[model samples]
Every structure is written in C-alpha cells, then in structure tokens.
Target: MVKIVALVGTNSENSTNRQLLQYMKAHFANQAELELLEINHLPLFDKPADKKVPEVVRQMALTIESADGVVISTPEYDHAIPAALLNALNWLSYGIYPFVDKPVMIIGASYGTLGSSRAQAHLRQVLDAPELKARIMPSSEFLLSHSLQAFDENNELIDQDMVAQLEGLFEDFLVFMQITSQLGHAHSVNQKLAESVSWENR
Candidate 1:
C-alpha cells in the first residue's frame, strides 16, 4: 500500500493544524495509507550527546524513510514555524537523511487573517537544506483566517469550496509522488546492477 506520513507540528490537543491534516488524510481514504507523526515526543537536539539518539527521534526518522511522501501541517508561532517542527527536522538531519530528495508538501493553518503566511515563508527557507527538496504550495493554497471555525470536531471540512480545492491539491500531489517513486526505484535497480558488475570484475 502507498504510505504517506502526515506530520502535525502542534502539541495542542485541539490544534487546528491537526484538524486540517486529518481532513487531508480523509481525502486519501483507501487510495493510500496515512500515518500521523507526532512531534511532541521528540527531545531537543544536542550534537555533543548525539551518540545516543532519542527513541522518538529514531522512530520519526524510520517513519519518514518508509513513507512514499510527507505532508507537513504546521501552525504559525510568532510569525514562524513552530519550534517543535524545527526540532523534528533537526533530528531527521542525522545519518538517515530522511528528507533527502523526498517528496514533501507543506500546509499551514492559523486563526490569523493571513493564515500563517509568514510562518509558511519561513518554513520554505528552512526546508531549503541541500538534502531536502520541498514542493511548497503557492500562497493561495495556505488555509487560514477561519481555519479554527471552518472544521467541526470530527475534522470534516465544512466549506464546500475549500474541500474541493484541497481535494484537487492532494490529487496532484499524489500523481507527482508516484512519478518520483518510479524514478527512484529505477535508479536503485541500476545502482545495484552496477555494484554486481563491479564484483564480477574483481
């Protein structure tokens, strides 16, 4: 089954970003398996003590490594991505390099009128690490303003137009990920063949 890990960066139990992510997951239904990555459990990064990585951090990396793609749902905090999200990204920067060439998409939701626009922009910059290639959506795709009031407790989107737009965005993202996965598989097979040929020559 195709798997996509949805990362929610807020620790709040009633976070609107989490609700938005749940709505996105609903769009996939049986087409893809969705796993939610909780960022609250990760400890802060410290290079000196990096020899022993936290279990939560390691689990997060493994999840990202196994997934076909990632969808990050974040809320604005002082005009920037939440520290929890940044911390999670830092932990993933270890040897695993889970985000390397991974198909990733970012969505932000907030109660503010701009809907976490500043935070989204800041995140786009941080995700520009050499190991990661992020496919950030345009400003129009940012869900904000009445995000908290837009969805019910069940995480079902109440706005018809918003639901339609989100569906279209997810459809396009899935197609893009499929193409990328095909190319990655081909590359891996070619590399394995090259290794075998080298051993035969030896």
Candidate 2:
C-alpha cells in the first residue's frame, strides 16, 4: 500500500485547513495507508541545540523519511505561509533533508478572498530548494472568500464541486508518486549496476 503523510500546518483546533485535510484523508482511508502529522507539537527551531533534538522533531523527521509522499494543507498568514509551517520545514531540513526529492503536494485554505494563494506561492518558493521534489497540481483553484461559512459545524465539506476537485487532485497525486517512486528505484538499480561493473573490471 502507498504510504502517505498528511501534514497539517495550522495550530488552531478549528482550523479549516485541518478539516479539509482530514476530509482528504477520509477519501484515501481504505485505498492507502495514511498518517497525519500536525505541526502543533513541533517546537521553534534552535540552531544551538542541534545535537539534542526534541523528541517531537525527531519523530517528525522519521515520519517524513518513511512516507512515500506528502500532502500539506496550510493557511496563509500575513500574506505568506504561517510561521509554524516554516518551523516544521526547518526541523526537517536540518539533519537528513527528508523532503529532498520527496514527492509533495500542497493545498491551502483561508477565509480571505485570496484563499491562501499567497501562502501557497511562498510555500512553493521554500520547497524549491534544489533537493526538494515539489509536485505542482494542474488544477490550481482557490477555495475561499466564505470557506468557513460554507462548511458546517462538523467541518464536513459542503460544496459538491469542491469535494470533487479535491478528490481528483489526490487521485492524480497518488499516480504521480507511484510513477516517480518507480523511476527513483530504477535509477538506484542502474547506479548500483554501474558501480559493480566498474569494480569487477578493476
């Protein structure tokens, strides 16, 4: 089964982004092995304490490393990605660069008109690091300007079309991850073969 880690970037208990991500998780409940990683547990990054990392940070790194792919749901704050998300990324990048070359899909939600578009753009920039493999979804549309009001108290997605779009994005992301993983495995096999042949000839 495909292992997917759903990263929720909001700290609020009633975060719309979190709710949306949970909805996506439900869609893949039986089809894929899903794990949720919330950013609330992560402490602020500290360069000085590099040798003794917090347990939460250590766990976060392990999760990112083990997952076949990642799905991030975030909210825009001050026209950019939230500080919490940035902190989590900092932790992930410190040791092993867990996100490097890892398949990632990002989605954003907000109550403003922009629907976290600016934040998403900022996130894309951060993930543009040479080693990171960020997957850009073809259907890029904002779900906002009344997002909170549209959803019910239970956090269930009320709009049918919105639900359909999210489902399609997840489906496409799963396919993209599978193909890329196979390609990576193939590349690794070829490199090993080349090394073995060189050693044998020597």
Candidate 3:
C-alpha cells in the first residue's frame, strides 16, 4: 500500500480540518495507509543558532521523508494558512529537506463559502520555495465548505457529490505518486540544493 502522511494544519482541538483528514484516513484505508500527523505540538520556530532541531521534529521529518506522498489539510486564518502549519513547515525545512521533490496533495476545509481557497493558494506558493520544492498535484483541489455540516455521525462525508469528488482526487493522487516517483532524476540534486540554501546570504 502507498504510505501517505496527512498533516493536520491546525492546533485547535475542534478543527474541522483535522476531521477532514480523519475522514480520508478511514475512507481510503483499503487503498493507502494514511498516517495523520499533527502540527499542534511543534514549538514555535525560532531559527536557532545551533541549527539543531528538536528530536520530535526530526522524527516527524523522517516519517515524512519516507512517505510516498503527503496530504496537507489546511484551514484559512486571515485568508492564509494557520501559524501552526506554517511553523511546522518552517521546522521541516530548516537544515532538512524532507519535502524536496516529494509529491504533495493539498486539501482544505472552511466554514465559509470560499472553502480556504486563499490558504490553499498560499500553501502552494510556500511549498514551491527553494528549501521545500514539493511536487504538488496539478489541477487538483478538494475543498470542503461549510465543513461543520460536511460529515455525519459516522465521521464520513455526508454529501454524495463531495464523496465522489474526494474519491476521484484520491485516485488521481495515487497515480500522481507513481508518476512523481519516476520523475526523481533530479531528486538528489534538489535535496542538496535545498540543504545548501543560505539564510546568512539573504
């Protein structure tokens, strides 16, 4: 089975973003092994002088590095991704290159109508940074609007159309993973370049 790391992009206990990931985990259990990673416990990124990362953060990086792909479920805060998620990404990129050339799938949930469109766009830009270089799926997006009513008592998506959309995107992701795995001729170079990014020169 394909191994996927799903990042829960919020610190809130009642986050619908997390709920959306949970639903994906269960729904895709047969096709992929989805592990939900929480960004809530990561300490605020401080750009430490020693350049030593927390063991927990390192472990998180290791897990992400070994995954076939990543799924990030984000929520908009001030029309952008939450600070917690951004902080986690900061940690993941500092002196580490887990995201370099890694395949990524972006998803989002929101209570409002825009369905975190701005945040998803912002996330794509962030992931494309030289230090990250994640290969986000093209022409694909899964947005769950009015997320409070998107699920049911069984923790499954309530709307058939929404479920169908998710299923199609997920299938596309599986194919994308395979395609990206073969597009790794420059993977090592990308990782090295990402590691060599110098903040002191900036």
Candidate 4:
C-alpha cells in the first residue's frame, strides 16, 4: 500500500488545517493509507546535536522517513507558514534528514479571502533549502479559502468543482510518489556502494 503522512500546521486547539487534513485522509482512504503526523507534542527547534531529542521528535522523524510521501496541510500566520510547523521542519532538517528529497504535496486552509497561498509559497522556499531539499509537487496548488464554509458540517469539502480538481491532484500526486520511490531506491543503492568502498579502503 502507498503510505502517505499528513503533517498539520498550527498548534491551535481547533485548527481548521487539521480538519481539512482529516477530510483528505478519509477522502483518499481507498487509494492510499494516509496517516496523520501529530506535531503537537513536538518541542521548539532545539537542534538535536546538543540537546537530548524528545521521543516525540524522534517518532516524527521516523514517520516521515518511513512514509512513501508527505502531505503538508498548513495555515497562514502573518503571510507565512505557522512557526510551529516551521520549527518542526527545522528539527527534522538537522537530524535524520527525513525531508531530504522526500516527495511532498502542499495544501492549506485559511479564514481570510486569499487563503494560505502566501504561506504555501513561503513554505516552498523553506523546503527548497539545502538541508530539506523536498521535492514538492508541480501541479496547481490547493488552497481552501474561508475554510469554515468551504466544508460541510461533516467536514467534507462541498464544492463539487474543487472535489473534481482534487481528484486530478490526487492522481498526479500518486504518480509523483511512484517516480520518487524509484529515485529513492536508486539513491539508497548508491549510498550502500559508497559506504562499502570507504570501508574497503580503511
């Protein structure tokens, strides 16, 4: 089964981004095994080099590393991705390098008129950093504006048009994951070969 993990931003008690992710997870239930990465337990970005890494942080990194792909559902805060989300990423960037070359899909929700477009743009920049080097999807972005009304009482995205669009996005995302999986396999083999050579010369 194709396993994907959703990383939800905002530590808010009633985070709409979390709700949106829950809806998507259920929406894609038949196609993929979509799981949620609970980031609430993650502490601030204290670099793991010096401080003892929290158990939650270690589990978070392992979840991302093990997943076939990642879905980042974030909210905008001052026209940027929520600090909590960025902080979690910062921690992940330094430790196990889980985000390195990982295939990611970005989605967001906001109560404002513009949605979380700006935040997603900023997030793309962050993911492009050398430490993370995330391979984000190249399709039209998914942004849920006025998020409260965008969904039904049951949290289903009500817009049929948007639903159709997501269907397309999901299809593309699946193909992207497949290609990235091949790349990851090749990279892993290359790494083993390099390690063997180093060991032989020692």
Candidate 5:
C-alpha cells in the first residue's frame, strides 16, 4: 500500500483543521496508509533557518521522508499559514529536504467564506520554492469555508460537494505519486550511469 503522511497545520489541540484531516483519513484508509504527523510535538525552532535541526525534528523529517506522498490540512490566520506550521516546514527544509520532488496535496478549513484558500496559496508557494521543491497536486484544492457549519455533530464532514471533490483529489494525488516516483528513480539511474561512465574514462 502507498504510505502517506498527513499533517494538520496548526498547534491547537482543538483545531478544526486537525479534525478535518482525521475525517479525510477514513476515506483513504482502504486505498492507502495514512500516518498523522503532529506539528505541535515539534519543538518551536527559535534558531535561524540556517541552524541545525533538533533531534525530534530530525526524526519527524525521516518519517515524512519515508512516505510516498503528503496531505496538509491547513488553517488560515491573518491571511497566512499559522506560525507553528510554517516553523515546522522551515525546519524540514534545513535537513535533507524531504519534500524535494515529493507529491503533496493541500486542503484547508477556515471560518471565513473563502475557507483557508489564502493560506493554502501561501503554503503552495513555500512548497514550490527553489530550496524545498515540493510538487503539489495541480488538479484541485479542497477548501472548507464556514468550516464549523460544514461538519455535523458527529465530527464528520457533511458537505457532499466537498466530499466528492476530495475523492477526485485523492485519486489524482495517487497518480501523481506514481508518476513522480518513477521520474525520480529514472533520473537517479541516469545520473549514476553518467558518473560511472566518467569514472571508466578516467
């Protein structure tokens, strides 16, 4: 089965974004293995971006690196991603660059009518930055606006339209994973071959 890491981009224990992520996990359980990585557990990186990663952060980075794909359930704060979530990402970038070429799917929930669309956009830009190079699923973004009303008392998402969109996005993400992994492997092989040929000539 495909291994996927799911992150709820907030430090709040009562986060609706985390709830939405857990709810989505049920949909992909049969098709893929989803491991929820908590950002709150990470030590707040007060050091500069150039500083070394803490041991805990390094382990989390490894767990994420082992995954085939990633899903981020984000929340908007002041029209941007929450500070804690962004901090976790910054630490990840300092190490082995786990997100480099990794397939990612971003979704968000917000109190506003626009959902966390603005935060999602900012996240995509960060992921696509030259240093990180995460490949986001380009097909669709699943945004839940007025999020509290979007779910029912059972802590389940009740919006049929968003559910349908999520299903489609999941399908596309799986395909994206397979294609990107193949491309990554092929490039590695070519690079190795070129090095071997050069060594033989020397």
Candidate 6:
C-alpha cells in the first residue's frame, strides 16, 4: 500500500480541515495507508541560529520523507493558510529537505463559498520555494465549502457529489505520485539545493 501523510493544516480544537482529512483517511483506507499528522503541538518557528530543528519536527519530517506522498488540508484564515501550518512548514524546511521532489496534494475546507481558494494558491506558491520544492499536483482541486455542514453525524461527507469528487482527486493523486517518482532524476540535485538555502545568510 502507498504510504501517505495527511497534514491537518490547523491547530483549532474544532477544525473542519481536520474533519476533512479524517474523512479522507477512512474513506481511502483501502487505496492507501493514510496517516494524519497534526501541527498543534509544534512550537512556533524561531529560526534558531544553530539551525537545530525540534525533536518533534524532526520526527515529523522523517515520517513525511518516508511517505509516498503528502495531502495537506488547509483552512483559510484571513484569506491565507493558518499560521500553525506555515510554522510547521518553516520548521520542516529549515535544514531538512523532506519536501524536495515530494509529491503533494492540496485540499481545503472553508466556511465561506470560496473554499480556501486563495489559501490553496498561497500554499502552492510556498511549496514551490527553493527551500521546499514540493511537486504539487496541478490543475486539480478539492474544496469543501460550508464545511460545517459538509459532513454527517458519522463524520463522513454527506454529499454524494462531494464524495465522488474527492474520490476522483485522490485517485489522481495516486497516479501523480507514481509519475512524480519517475521524474526523480534531479531529486538529489534538488535536495542539495534546498539544503544549501540559508535564510539567515540571505
């Protein structure tokens, strides 16, 4: 089975983003082994001079590196990704290059109708930075709007149409991962480049 890390992009106690990822985990259990990673406990990124990443962040990076791919479900806060998720990404990219050449799928849930469109676009830009260099899936989006009512009492997506859309995107993600794996000729170069980036020096 393909190992995938589903990043819960918020630290909120009652986040619809978390619910969306949970639903994906259970819904796609047969197709992939999805592990949910939370950023709630990671301390705010401070860019220590020594560049030593926190133990928790290091472990999280290892998990992400070992996975076949990552799925990030974000929530929009002020038309942008939550600070918690950005903090987590900052730590993950400080000195480690886990995201370099890694396949990523972006999804989002929001209270408004825009469905975190701006946040997802911001996330894509962030992931494309030299330090991260994630191979995000293109031309594919899964946005759950009015997320509070998107699920049922059982925590499953209530709308059949939404479920269908999610299923299609997930299947595409699996294929995207396979294609990305084959495009790894520059993986070593990319990793080295990403690791060489030092924000403090710049």
Every model's TM-score: 0.83, 0.82, 0.98, 0.88, 0.87, 0.98
Superpose all Cα atoms of candidate 5 onto the true structure and report the RMSD in Å to 1 decimal.
6.4
What's the TM for model 6?
0.98
1-202 per-residue lDDT for model 2 (tens digits): 8998989988878888887777777767877777888998777877643356577787787888799888788899998888989888766655435675577888878887778888888888887653343444445544554568657777667887877877777788888787767666544443344234321222
Q: What is the C-alpha lDDT of each candidate?
A: 0.72, 0.73, 0.94, 0.82, 0.82, 0.94
Clashing pairs in 4: none
- Tens digit of per-residue lDDT, candidate 6, span 67-155: 99999999998988999999999998998889999999999999989899999999999999999999999999898999999999999
lDDT of 5 by residue, 1-202 (tens): 9999998899998887888888877777899998889999887666544456788888887998899999999999998999999989877865346777778999999878998988999999888765467779885788889987887887777888888888888898999999888768554443344234321222
- Which has the better lDDT: candidate 3, or candidate 4? 3
Candidate 5's TM-score: 0.87
lDDT of 2 at 136: 48
lDDT of 4 by residue, 59-169 (tens): 888989899999998899999998888888877765346777789999899998877999999999998876677789985588888888888888899988878887889
Q: Which portions of model 5 show Cα errors greater than 4 Å? A: 48-51, 185-202
**How far out, in Å, is residue 89 in model 3?**
0.6
Q: Give per-residue CA lDDT, model 3, range 39-134, as digits (tens).
A: 888999988788799999999999999999999999999989999999999999998889999999999999998889999999999999999999
Pairs of colliding residues, candidate 6: none
Candidate 2, lDDT over the whole model? 0.73
Which is better, 2 or 3, measured by lDDT? 3
TM-score, structure 2 vs. true: 0.82
Off by over 4 Å in 2: 131-145, 185-202
Tell how far residue 145 is off in model 2, in angstroms: 4.5
CA displacement after TM-score superposition, residue 54 of candidate 6 (Å): 0.8
- TM-score of candidate 4 to 2 decimals: 0.88
